[model samples]
Target: MSLLDIDGVSVDLGRAPLTRVLDEVSLRLRAGEVVGVVGESGSGKTTLARSILRSVPVAAGSLRIDGRDVRGLRGGTLRAWRREGAVQYVFQDPLRSLDPGVRVVDSIAEGLRIARVPSEERTRRIAAALRDVGLDPELAGRLPGHLSGGQRQRAAIARALVMQPRLLLLDEPVSALDAASRDRIIRTLIALRDAHRERLGMLVISHDIGSLAALSDRLVVLYRGRIVEDGPTRQVVARPRHPYTRLLIASVPVIGVAGADRTERAALRAAIDA
Candidate 1:
């Protein structure tokens, strides 16, 4: 059975006059797979993520995890779904989800605490989570404000990882950082996925093709609230079937071009493609 199944899902926001945010989106993510959803702003990528997490009410279709219908859950059942680490979310803005004053270890331990894990076990898991995200275990004692953006994001990833969820929903996880920091965070996520491939599946939502190209095994491109293309990561990026996908690939900055002439030509080509 698929670890995460989303079928013909649609989401409507507002009451009186509704706006369809997601439209008949269907996706299946298997255990250990990394799938990326890419689109421009307002393309319903985030809404789709929220739909999977059940933060938004689905207007149509069904959502399932491990063959269990998530929409049928309520109250304690829903809480149990989260507490048991069946699925976890790591948002785009790490600071929004991570408290500034809290110690790194404690922030990461919040989920475990809710699950009522013993203090001793929480400590061990916290350290392991930090290590899993490629951070020094000693750094857990520091406050959030003391860490670099990349470190803080890694800390955020650790917080989600500590839950030991089967699937992770990441909404632009590295889009908030500087170039160097973005690269570092992306590497950390890929390493985490590689290390726990058998037990973890991930859904990364981003407009950054490079980030998704590096981390995801498959890519699903969204345009105006619907999937325009879905295929293997390399295949889609290399030879895009949809025009939107082509625009995304053409936007990837070609690095290490030192000569002024080649750089100028490449820049012009990118501009033309755009």
Candidate 2:
């Protein structure tokens, strides 16, 4: 069985005609496999992540972790499920997700507390988590406000890691960082995944095709609130099947393409063929 499974999941806001933000979206992730959900803004990628984490109510369908159905969990059961570290989320904005007043070590230790780790073990784990994310042990006492954006993100990652979660949901994790920082974070994430392969599954949501391609074993493309393409990363990147996917690939600026070569005439022919 897959480590995480989302089948026919749908989410909507209020009674506004039940606008289907996700239309029967289905996905599966095995232990250690990294899956990328790629789409433009408003394509329901965030909604899918929220639904899996049980933050957003699932309007319809099933969400399962480790083969246990979670669609009907409520109140204390849901809280317990979350505390058990069935799934963990890393938000795009680390600042928004972190507490400005809390020390970095405290934030990472909070997960251990939730899991009922002993105090001494929690301390050791927090330090290890910090080191795993490439943060200095000395920064443990620093508040989020005192850290750089990259450091804050590392802290957030450490907080999630301390839980030893089975599934990790990354929502545009690198979108808020500068190019260099993003690269550093991406490498850190890759290393972390390698180290925790036996205990983790990941679903990464991002609009950057290149970054997604770099990290994902498989790719699913969302468009207009539905999946337009789902396939192996190399297949999706080299031979995109859907028209929208082709358009997205074409829109990426190519080096050495002169201004005239990027003319409407060329685009028109490409669009026609696509």
Candidate 3:
């Protein structure tokens, strides 16, 4: 069974007119797979991520994790689900998600502490999480300000992994980094995926198709609030069926001479082609 299931889910943001921000969206992320959600700004990309976390209320349809319908869980039960670390969210800006004053290891350990994990065990898990994200275990003692942008992001990912979550929700995780840093972060994610014995389902929300192409098994193109395309990343990118999907492909900038070699063109082409 899939680790995360969101079926025909709809979300209303409570505007005066009460429009649906997510319109009957259905997606499944099985263990050991990554699905990327792509769209322009305000395409309800963030809303969909929140919907999985139950931070945004659903108006219709069902959402489930580990076969339990999250829509049916309320109050204490719902809060408990979030606290259980069945799922975790890695924010777009790692710096903002972390406190400058806090030690990197402490940031990762906070969840363990709240869950009342044994002090020794928490310390052990913190080091392992850091190593999983391709960081030196010793750096855990440094403050957020001491790390590079790429390192800080890795620390954020480490924090999520520390919870031992079955599913990871990554929102524009690499959108803020430079090409080098972005590549490093993506490599770390790939390593984490490979290192896990069980499939670690992931929902990566981003506008960067090229990066998503590198990481996702499937690509879901969202238009407005609807799912216009959902299929293997290669299939959808090579022969996009939806008009919105075509528009999105057409909108990507042509390769330029700066990095525009045959290699860049081919990589960009492979991102969409067979």
Candidate 4:
């Protein structure tokens, strides 16, 4: 069975006349699998990640984790689930996400504190998490402001890892890093996935198709809140079936054609109109 299952889910944000940002979105993530969600800006990638964490209410369809219905969880049960760290999220901007005043160790231990983990165990986990992300344990005493951009991002990832999450939702996790830092982060993720040995699942949301092609086992392409294509990363990158998917690949110089053809864009627009 899939570790994470999202079946025909939809999300409507705002009050009164709700705006549909996600429509009939169905995807699944298996243990030890990294699935990448790729799309242009405003394509509802972040919303989908938020919905999985139950930060946004699902308007339709079912979301299940480990065969338990997520929509049915309520009150203490929901809070407990969240607090237990079954799922963890790594935001795009670690500098903003990590508290400037808090030491790295404390920030990484926040969730454990909430869950009432013993202080001694928390320290062990925090150090282990930092190592897992290739951060030095000695740096844990420093504040977020003191760390470099790459270190800060890895610290944020360590914060998530400290939770020992079964499913990881990384929203544009490497977008803000430099080329070298980005490559290191990607390598760290690969190592972590291998270390987990099928006990963990990951959903990576990014706009960079090239990076996704390298990191993901499967790729799910979203266009206007809908999944236009889903397949093996190599297959999708090598042979994109949808116009929007083609455009995404073409836009990435390192992955496909240097630029998307103007005529193809025009044809896509016409197709959408028809």
Off by over 4 Å in 3: 253-274
Task: Rate residue 154 of model 1 by lDDT.
Answer: 88
The C-alpha TM-scores of every prediction are 0.91, 0.91, 0.90, 0.95
Query: Which whole-number lDDT from 0 to 100 does residue 196 have in model 3?
Result: 78
- The candidate 2 region of ten consecutive residues with least summed lDDT is 253-262
RMSD of each: 4.0, 2.9, 5.2, 1.5
Error of 2 at 140 (Å): 2.2
Candidate 2 lDDT (Cα, 0 to 1)? 0.83
Residue-level lDDT tens digits of model 3 in 72-183: 9889998888889989999999977678899988888989988999998998888888888888877778999988888899999999998999999999999999889999
lDDT tens digits, residues 165-264, model 1?
8999999988889999998888888888889988899999999887898889999999889998999998887777765676667667551122336555
Candidate 2, backbone clash total: 0
**What are the lDDT scores of the predictions, listed in order?**
0.85, 0.83, 0.85, 0.90
True-structure lDDT of candidate 4? 0.90
Candidates 3 and 4 compared by lDDT, better number: 4
User: Quick one: best TM-score, which candidate?
Assistant: 4
Tens digits of lDDT, candidate 4, 8-56: 9999999979999999999989999999999989999999999999999
